[model samples]
Target: MEKEKAHESQNSKLTHENRFGLGSSEHVSIEHDPDDLWGDSRVIVNIGPTHPAMHGALRMVAKLNGETIESSYCQFGYTHRAKEKLGENRTYHQFVVYTDRLNYCSSLLNNVVYAMAVERLMGIEVPPRCTWIRMICCELARVIDHLICIGINAVDLGAFSYFLYGFHQREEAYTLIEKLCGARLTTSYTRIGGLMYDAPDGWEKEVKDWVVRTRKVIDEMDRLLTTNKIWCDRTQGVAIFTKEDCLSYSYSGPNARAAGIDIDLRRDQPCLFYRDVEFDVPIAKEGDVYARYRVRLEEIRQSLNIVAQCADKVKKGPIWSEDKRVKIPDKTLVHNTMEGMIHHFKFFMTGFDVPEGEAYTTFEAANGELGFYIVSKGAPRAHRMRIRGPSVYHYQGLDLMVRGEKIADLVAALGSINIIAGELDR
Candidate 1:
């Protein structure tokens, strides 16, 4: 028909590349065909590998019909350092620093989890004091991670003050970390069979005080956002990823729990001192942006309780295992004695060997299930090392989650998931 031919001709002109070598020029655009609702109306939009709304070096390309996203694809690896490959080449001790870069917001959890995986493979049981301290560190890291997640989620939805409420507490938590390891953001605090050092004198008390302040701040954040009309409008019933969809995409942690998946590795698969601690796993059935926000807020409270319990229970004792092969010589001895200096140099250069074995260790990290799979052929370095970061799986679900939603909702959903580029592209 003549009409069909005319439509085809118009589309061809619209498809032509612009003079500037970008997409089709608007000057050559065509009107929509009567037969097709989306003809010439759908446009492609690139959200970001470098957009402000995007939390990290993540890109989402979407085809849009007006303001609604018709379909989308997420691309990552912009900040990839091939962390797993680095794990293979670097000594187990050296690789601890690399873990810090994974989820830099809560680097301590990554450090603890990586160390735990290597320790399990070596058949080393760290002392009780060490185990308890690791648990406290993990909980503190979880709190900081969740605070940033929800706070930033609010800021994305136009609640800047709400972010500051949690951020102040985040800084307080960092001070405690500094006291423990002399570093704040990327504190490489956990060592193979021990920590960098035991908590400095009165560090536990400071942690407890931080917890008390954080709880009040959390309550304030809940009051500020949970019932506010605009916040509810932006988040409630938006980007609803069902429980079935979550399972299909391998969702874990708060994101999965928000969809009514009653899984918390810390509870279901108890590791370290998880079995000894008393805490609750928060769950929500709605699975909307609001539900995800609520889940994280509640998680922060639970982590606070865990930190308090740890502070009360942790007592003075050896923080490292007696295993000479894994333990680092004391700093004072290493500096003062010639034999100690030589031992230290050899340890750093050659590294200790692990037994010929393989082990996969999973922990309930801040974002979700963080796992380290190690295959060792009795070498100082891993034969093969793989990290299973939750962001990879969570990011995969983004396309499905954003389909049919407005472009603004994409920002909300992405922030709620807390996609870390290091872990995602690893």
Candidate 2:
């Protein structure tokens, strides 16, 4: 009780730096009770700044009445790195690495989205081959991201088998990523107007094999946990948010779909070759932990289907556009030809300038709608920049959804949303 009062006293001073949202996305000041005038049964607990249930780098300050939560406030500055400011300071090409940190589970998606924004700003359309590759990368990363979210959520609830099966398949996907980017986790594998390179020889065959193997693992997970009474009990009706609440809180991606709100950018606002592919946007009305799990599980299957289609249709073609502005010259040409040497030097020394304009590009990232809003005055770096990461809104909904829910349900809800602190704080 004393702890709760002390913390409330501290919060009373810092309310401006940390504001709490209502049940909706709109912010409203919450009264802090520095005195335990309510009751002595209530316990104040700090969930995490470094707890496993936090999925690393998230902290929540919650006031609990017995095991049920009363009020909750989440803090996210622990992993804050001034990423949006970095976008403004660094050249467009240099900012891609920073995006990798935003949602580390699907760095490839970040790379592609930021690339799309830069390409849009410069008025360059990537080749058919490049767009296809980007789509494949996005889906592959989706598979990996969804795998982590579902597997970890189950693991948090004491189901280890799913985590093992899902992680093994995730590693297989990483092998394909490594083959393409020469790195696994933080893959800076995109160029502004194209990819770092064309798919390595026979890479499509490797991805097809991985997808086949991953499907078996997904099926095994469904059999192992989907009907398990323990999982169902823990997740079925817990941490529910109604469709209206989902909209009010600006929920997107799987979180929104889990609440029976169908708004996938890939279908409604198609970009790249997303419209060319056919896949279902899985949704559920339960808006509970189980629904989020099911939505992600089904989405993984759809992503696998997309990956298969991309692999089959990935015909050989030019990977980079003819736009020399963003293209790094071929090394052989750089060493031998004066023209190539000059172009290479100019490209790196004076990075391609953008026209004096601004544009906002949105990509259906694994988490949700990832939008990059950029303003440029024809400089290599952006004059102003902003990132609309879905996690921020998702985190806002946390306190409302977890109200009166058990402490254990809190863990499940956090994992279900898959909040990446880097994205949340930025």
Candidate 3:
């Protein structure tokens, strides 16, 4: 009880507000006579920062007529961390740790894209095994991300059983990630020239087994909720956005694809081993919450297929490039050779410098497009680093999407978009 109290106290110091969709410092104001306006009147309902539905650090102000929201206003910057500024101050090698925090659910993808941007600036190409392994890591991240988005969205809509079904699969996938890299979430597994280490022995076989099993679980989930009357009624035709709205809002990933956009970085701008692997980018025409849900469901299957294929292709080879400046020497070599020892020490202590250049690399992340823009001026750290998160555009469209939507449907719409606050406020 004392520990719980201390935790709550720490959170209170940050934002002393949260409960049943209201902020502690905010208030309720009733205008005019309640009886006279009982039949018809607009009330200003405040879904404050402390509200249970809202993240304690964020808020949504919705103007509603009875149970339906006539208009909506989104409040942001509640959890800004100046992550970009931190990237500018930190070395390329050191900044790998911060990438994990950007999209915490799929940190591997974040690590890969950031590394790719830096690698491009330096004109480095990782080995074949490294490329295949990176593909597997990305697909694993995709499955885990989609599972959480689908499960939590279901839970938010009162379908608790479905959430558990998807969550079990997500946990199983995390175990595989833990095997590949020491940690599961916030994985700082990627390095500038290659991965931190090679994939473990027989790792592909275990991943293949999981892929087949996960497909079964996803199939069952689709059967459970795809055609369910409750889910359909709750999500279908809600938060509809046309292709024009998607383009205007600069939306990407599943949300934009649901509205009939066909651009996926993997296909449109193939990089790594994506060109060699075959996968489909799911699309829908409705542009509603239900369409977004369907797109994610199909995407999970496609990601699994990619993972299975990559597993078969992965073989014994050098994981890191021969780039001495960027590659970390093996532990055995460092201990046996003096030259290896000094190189490793200097690499970490002084860090490698890239020629003054800039590059932008974008990947088709679990939710949408995740890009990194890196500028170097012969400095150990980046001159400037910019993160292009899909959440920024999706959150911008929230006020428009939720207009005329019921408060209940707002939760479902937000979930389908898969807006991670860490990335949104970075």
Candidate 4:
């Protein structure tokens, strides 16, 4: 009884201290909404953790009046795995694996961002071929992710055939990814200075074949949904947000593109091999769900174009640099030479040291600006690492979109936002 009381007292004291901390109490109170105690509202609808259209374990308490939403509140943390806390305990390389969990639809991009940020902090220079390969693979991932988003949105809007067709193409893309990397969904293929391994022999031909097949699939998807009267009626002019509004909310990628903001990190920031490549950024004037859908579909074409360019420009060269500090020495050399063996052992065990600096690297992810902010205290492991996820921003804009719109449109709006809960909760 005494121990229980002491425990409670300790918790209370901690809570009191936390409440008084700088900006902590203010943020907590806003998130918790203590005034929601009465549960009194007109036509309250709870769409939730178990709902088919909810995507992941997310709940939205919406108040409506005859097909018009008055106000809405989102509930998260159901799928939270304490990713930030988990990063603190793991080594730099081990943390790369955890990044696969965030925005699992485009896990490769997440891993790339994490690795790139670390590389920046470490001042490690990757090979040109590796950078180009990362760009190509991440662009492919963007297309795959958009297919899921647009197709799923169509499904929610009662177009089942489109979903099947899109997913079919996505599966083909997945197979290609699986062939390139050992794993499809969770591809930790990227290392500090280069890939885990070079693209397999004849991988270029495989990429070409997939591009041809995907172009056909894209044509079929367009015919099935893009020009269909039902699809147009359901999506056009629904859940609109302007360019200014999106910018104010820190929106990025397709969401921003849909609002006529022509900002693609690949073009504007020019990271990796993006500067050498040529591709168009598709933009739509209308910020409706349909506009977002159209932007994504057009983006698939751009990605295919980039893949073709990469295939043509790609040369037979070393994928990894000759930096012993960043990359392990060749196995043949390690076995035959003492110096090579020593270099390999040192890299694997101690890892390389990073410069004492911070860098913020942003990439054009499937959803939006997937950013990684890393602060290195001159250690192999980062002093601090933060992920800037699009889903969180998308979730923040949900109330604005859903309110005053039909309950049925909720699913369409949510799908268009492409709020993968993994990214949101993380």
State the displacement of the C-alpha of residue 240, model 3, in Å, after optimal TM-score superposition. 0.5
lDDT of 4 by residue, 239-303 (tens): 99888889888888999899999899889987778888889999999999999999999998999
Query: How many residue pairs clash (N, CA or C atoms closer than 3 angstroms) in each of the candidate models, in the order given?
Result: 0, 0, 3, 0
Per-residue C-alpha lDDT of model 2 across residues 1-426, encoded as one tens digit per residue: 999977775564445434432334243344544343333447899978989899878899998876778899988878889987887788877787888988899999999999999889889988888888899999999989999999999999999988999999988888899999899999999988888878899998998988898898899899999999999999999999989999999999999999999899999999989888889999899999999999999999999999999888888899898886788899999999999999888777767788889999998898998999999999998998899999999999999999989888999999999998878887
Candidate 3: misplaced stretches above 4 Å? 1-40, 48-52
Worst 10 residues of 4 by lDDT: 32-41
Put down candidate 3 lDDT per residue, 1-426, tens digits, no spaces. Answer: 999976764454334224344455443332323332222347778775666555335678887776688888888777798989998888889999988988899999999998889999988989899999999999999889888888888888888899898889888888988888889897899999999877789999999999999999999999999999999999999989889999999999988999999989899989988998889889999999899989999999999999999999998998888987798878898999999899888888878998898888899988788989888998888999999988888889988888888888888887878888878888
lDDT of 1 at 196: 88
Error of 3 at 307 (Å): 0.6
Q: Write the per-residue lDDT of candidate 1 for residues 1-426, one digit (tens) a residue.
A: 999988876665445434335464555445544544444457899878999889989999999887788899989999999888998999999999999999998899999999999989988999988988999999999999998999898899899999999899999888899889999998999999998888888888888988898888888889988999999999998999999999999999999999999999999999888888899999999999999999999999999999999999999999999999888998898999998998899899999998889998999999899999999999999999999999999999999999999999999999999998888887
- TM-score, cand. 1: 0.91
Error of 2 at 71 (Å): 0.5
Q: Using lDDT as the measure, which candidate wins?
A: 1
Task: Give all TM-scores, in the order shown.
Answer: 0.91, 0.90, 0.89, 0.87
Q: Which one wins by TM-score: 2 or 3?
A: 2
lDDT of 4: 0.83
Q: What's the ranking of the predictions by lDDT, best on top?
A: 1, 2, 3, 4
Q: Which ten residues in a row have the lowest lDDT in candidate 1?
A: 13-22
